[model samples]
Target: MRPRKPALRPGKPMVRRGVPVGSPFRLLLLGASFALTGYAGVRLLADDWFAVAVWFVGAALLHDLVLLPLYAVADRSVVRGLDATGHRDRALYVRVPAALSGLLLLVWFPLISGRVERRYRLGTGLSPDGFLARWLLITAVLFGAAALLLALRLRRATKQRPPATH
Candidate 1:
């Protein structure tokens, strides 16, 4: 005699046992992306792509081993500084703009500093002369905008609050 299987209710969607909460469509998409990445990686191996592959692996390892610790320490320092000051308000305003600007600088350092001017110009047919100035201006704008928004939000919040009684 066979054991009886549990029946699923009609209204609830069928969920696989041992799986965490997530949409079936999202799981399907994740599987497809992994498959496509594996396919591309295999194709790259066939084209004598060892150097590029090794460089990518090395870069990943370097970022994990070095950059991750450095950034973590910096962030911890900032948090500690805020804690020491006893004024933690608007930390997100500073952190968000600084993080975005740092990421932009990291991504565009070579172009911004003209270190790879010839290579960049050859590849894209565009000059890299203005990159440094543009990046600085963008950094300033990001911080300025963040500061303005924080000020506005604080002002509105203050207006909405009732006055403290003596």
Candidate 2:
């Protein structure tokens, strides 16, 4: 005789064919996301599909071949430096701002560097000359804010420490 399956208890996920089914709300969100993705794919393919395909492939290759290794090395170096200085726990203070600044730089490189100033001006009737300065200012603000938060955390930590015996 075949062995009987165990009964499912309340709050436990339902199992079907060796797979666990997610909650109804999670499944609904998943289905909605799939539908949205399908709609976007159809719309994109209807337009200049070749350009989109090329952009996607080029982005993937660039990220895998160049960006990934460069960032990985940089991150490892930062972590190693922090660990050496006994500030490993403070690494996130540097990382978060740097990552945000890097993302902003990546997204606005042409404009930030003034390389697309003329084209941008002609297309949008607005000068793109301040992008570089604005980007620098924003980066400075991000780093400054991160430093302030780290200082506050350090102060709080020191205050909570037990008194040391002589």
Candidate 3:
């Protein structure tokens, strides 16, 4: 005897073999992403495949062995400090800016620190001098915006709350 298919509710997602498959639009998006990744992989491999493979392996090892633990510890410390200060709910304000800053630093490290000045200038014919300043400015802006948002949220909450009783 064949197994009966499960009946899906009007608003519920479709499930196949006990796994939620999500909407057809999501499946189409996933397929398109996979195809794009495969195309990029083919083009990359057509170049220096060995160097790319080695770099990928090295990046994976470095992230797993070093970066992962470092960030985990840093995040835990932040959470602990916020929790102790009774402002744990406001951790996102600190985390978002720090994460954006860290990402910018990571992506532009060589240029920002002037390590690749000669190579970058040779390739692009432009000096890689102002990246550090620009990155710092962007980091400042992200933090300032996050702080402003937090201040507004606090003000709104205060206004919404009733007056304290004696």
Q: Look at candidate 3 and give me any clashing residue pairs.
A: none
lDDT of 2 by residue, 22-88 (tens): 4677677889999998899888878888988788788999899999999988988999999999999
Model 1 clash pairs are none
lDDT of 1: 0.82
Off by over 4 Å in 1: 1-57, 121-125
Give the distance in Å from residue 36's predicted Cα in candidate 1 to where it truly belongs: 14
Give the per-residue lDDT of model 1 (tens digit) for 27-125: 678889999989988887776688878887989998999989987888777777887898576567778888898899899888888999999889999
Model 3 per-residue lDDT at 147: 95
Q: Ranking under lDDT, best-scoring first?
A: 3, 2, 1
Candidate 3 yields a Cα-based lDDT of 0.88
**What TM-score fits each model?**
0.60, 0.65, 0.65
Total clashes for model 2: 0
